[model samples]
Target chain A: MARTDPDISPAPPATERGRRTRRKLLDAATIEFGERGFHEASIASITRRAGVALGSFYTYFGSKEAIFRDLVRDLSEGVRQAAAQSLAERELDALETERAALAAFLAFAREHKEIYRIIDESEFVDPESYRLHYEKTAERILGRLRAGAAAGQLRGDLDEAHAWAIMGMNVFLGLRYAVWSKGEEDRPEHAAQAAATILSEGIGPSDA
Target chain B: MARTDPDISPAPPATERGRRTRRKLLDAATIEFGERGFHEASIASITRRAGVALGSFYTYFGSKEAIFRDLVRDLSEGVRQAAAQSLAERELDALETERAALAAFLAFAREHKEIYRIIDESEFVDPESYRLHYEKTAERILGRLRAGAAAGQLRGDLDEAHAWAIMGMNVFLGLRYAVWSKGEEDRPEHAAQAAATILSEGIGPSDA
Candidate 1:
């Protein structure tokens, strides 16, 4: 299946069989890697979890690193698509728009905690993979900001470059409250509201 | 033995001999781990780079994981102390305070790129580590928001829990920007102003 996000595209498996096998491997890897870190996680365990031959694992990707890269590519694409879809569905009000964005992030993180964890851990294990993750997020966010600016919903004078900065802050909050704060008390919905407030308000009095 | 930030109580080596040896290891590990992915990096290579014995690596820390922990803890504390010191040095105006915070983050990232990279990477490897990081940062930002609220700088209507929601957003942004973007492209300073604008201002023109 194709990923809808513009910044990153999934390199879907070459054939139907490849796609099924690939999906199984990726899904298995995400959970395995999430539960046991990269160092502790093993391919044998992943393939067993996937119910595939160990040979098939290497047949699709060269190594664990390669599999992780594809996973990043997939998750990043998922995030972009989710963001775009959310933005598209919301009314043009700034508050509603921010809620839609943060909701999309929280939803994604909830469903794909393991994948996000893999991507997060991959940063040190593999900077290239992490770079791919950041580029996709920044690009997707910049696109939305550009649209917000053009619509006159977001502030003017600031460029897309800066809009991405705020997006980074808002989404990172969701990442923290959702992904990082597992089991601990969390208020993701309220957190989303606060971020939206900050995005809309600028921490200073209106006159300033 | 400890990381002592002259400005903030932090880290350094334990004994002079320990200091020299540990410095070589920490410095080497930073480059090795940050520049090379953790998996490809071996203790043998790290020892070689530090010009220390492989046996000596164990003396510093039981395992590579332990070394990574220290590096992460030290970096995390360094960042907190630096941000606090920045806030303390002056009675920064609202926007100025944001600028100082952003500038402090950039400085920390630049000075200890490896450490930031590791901490960022740690989220995936050990989520407990990531949670600790989030809590430490949440404490700093929330403290500021609480102080601001007391001074009537921020909206008192939002509870402490709500203030934390706001804090999550920035923690996310700092980690993403620190790890990925080069230069001042992810200008937290400017972004803070932009964000502060909305947190204080209602999304619409008047009600806030």
Candidate 2:
């Protein structure tokens, strides 16, 4: 297939077997890129990790840069799907929905610690993808905040800044509690509770 | 003069002229590394930008890596000093202090747009310095939060996680409003107000 959209993967595999092979390459690429970083990471190494023939790499990806870019998009999509799955399972109020989304994200980050490395590195290796990941994520959060305001669950004045603040909180919480947790008690749910509390009530004194 | 602390600069300049030269080199490195990135940035380019001799580069920094590491520290210290300078100018309450600090930060970021790139790239170039920068910043914020609680300005139950949340909020807000902003209306004070409102009342319904 001749895929024209540069933002997405080039020519997604047509057959099931082709798709499976592409998936394997992506999975392996994640590890290679995560471990070795963009400069040191090689197409041959990715193919070796994927157990695919080196020549077949071109069947799915145009170049190493192509695969790296696609992997970033893949990871961004993975984050969205993870949160979407969590949100779909409940009819949560706005605050509760945010809490669930954060919890789900924390879980995802902890499970795939490489996600932070890959995404953060994209800021240097592929600036456009790095900016897109955050812009898209913030837009999604802004939409949720507007919905919450419409439903009377959140302050009506909430805007883009609010969404950016919430996204920042979630990102750093995942960084500390999920990626750098030193103890078993520092769980995703604990971080979610803290973030949820911040969203529900400012850290100011109760009477203040 | 020989310096004992490896964590600090290689050696302390004994003369005012030497100090000025070192300062010039660091300023140049900031532009070089910020624009060209770490791996691509070179000592020769830094010297050219600084209007200093290449041999003089070694008088302050032992190597390119050394200067980058020191530059990260210098940037981190600069952020601390900015917040401290803002905090010292007033006797505001906890929330107001945060607002002032963030406002100062946004202003600083606007002036030195290269800061975000340097600090962020340190994650790959010098992981230890990157981690130390955040850990120390969070410690400082945590100390302020404890003081705020002690003074009855903030919630009594605030902890390390709360400090991280606030730090993340400030970092991302600076990224959006100061670094990536496209319009004139997106000012530092506006971002500070939004952050202050969140810190004071959160995004929950007003009644809550």
Candidate 3:
């Protein structure tokens, strides 16, 4: 159940039951950390919330910081899988691919509203994970942009800055339309379309 | 020195000397909070950094949290002023205005690298100020977008989502190019141009 990884945290559980226990702990930790924050959140509270014994907590995570770091990595992977699963369903054009990826992200954000809170909190609780999350995410976007550019679907000059720009656009759009707004007018589809339009055609007047 | 306002924090000092003291405390608090973070940071440390007595701390801030909130507001205003000052000297078109705003932001961010750390930490420490900061910043961008639309310089259908999109682009770009990268390749002017190009003409192929 304990495999040490130099990168982020300890390795995954070896058995199914162990995995289930770890998952429960993580789910509980998500709520604890999300609601109370890193400073106020406690290991005992997390164990109590998970319906697991305090002694068993050490089986998966070495410390509170370990669990928090793992949780951020888990969430980061969740974001990646959300988009990956969505992208696998169809062969989209470059612009459509970007739109689909964002749509998936928005849907994911709505389902797991704690995502923003937990991820934002990581900036303080685990600065390395926080930076790693964005750096990796930006790298993924850059890869897509490069592919699009090579395929002649996107502008030839697309670079890392462009990827960062697109990433920023998707993040804020999710923050507004997904996390903040409760109105029916602010659907993920609508947000996706607005973003897609920006990608396909800039906001400048056509005559310009 | 304190004027009670229903908004973010206490009002400005009536006397220049009092104003200077408050400014000193805020400046010192920036270093204290930036270095130690919110939880570990103390009022005594901030006062010590200010070269002022601990008893004089209350002359400006009612509590550590009050000063933290004020600091977030102050940094938010600083960001606004950075862009505002840049924009004031120019009579550029819509795209050029955005370019200037982003360039100014990038430059400001480079000088005050702690702006990112402080503003981001506010999400957990002071959620209201965090939300208000982005909301207000987005509103400002939206106003500019609307003005561009009205002047027929930008798309007439541009809305809040568009503003958020542009805001996100600028934020991440600043985070990457200004706060993170210490390399010569990541210049503010270059970032500004990349974003402006997206605003003028998106990532879509030119022939398309």
Per-prediction tally of clashes: 24, 0, 0
Quantify all predictions' global Cα lDDT against the true fold: 0.66, 0.90, 0.90
Stretches > 4 Å off in candidate 2: A1-9, B1-9
Higher TM-score: candidate 1 or 3? Answer: 3
- What is the lDDT for A15 in model 2? 99
TM-score of every prediction relative to native: 0.77, 0.96, 0.94
- Model 3: per-residue Cα lDDT over A1-208, one tens digit each: 5465433445678999999999999999989998898889999999999999998988788889999999999999999999999999999999999999999999999988788889998988789999999999999999998899899999998888988999999999999999997689787788888889889989999776
Q: Residue B36 CA error for candidate 3 (Å)? A: 1.3
Reported per model, the fraction of native interface contacts reproduced equals: 0.39, 0.73, 0.85
DockQ of 3: 0.83
| Residue-level lDDT for B137 in candidate 1 | 73
**Interface RMSD of predicted model 2:** 0.8
Report chain A TM-scores, every model.
Answer: 0.82, 0.94, 0.93
Off by over 4 Å in 1: A1-18, A39-44, A53-63, A88-90, A181-185, A205-208, B1-29, B36-64, B93-95, B124-127, B157-208
Please report the interface RMSD of model 1 to 1 decimal.
4.1
Q: What RMSD does each model have against the real structure?
A: 6.5, 2.7, 2.9
Better of 1 and 2 by DockQ: 2
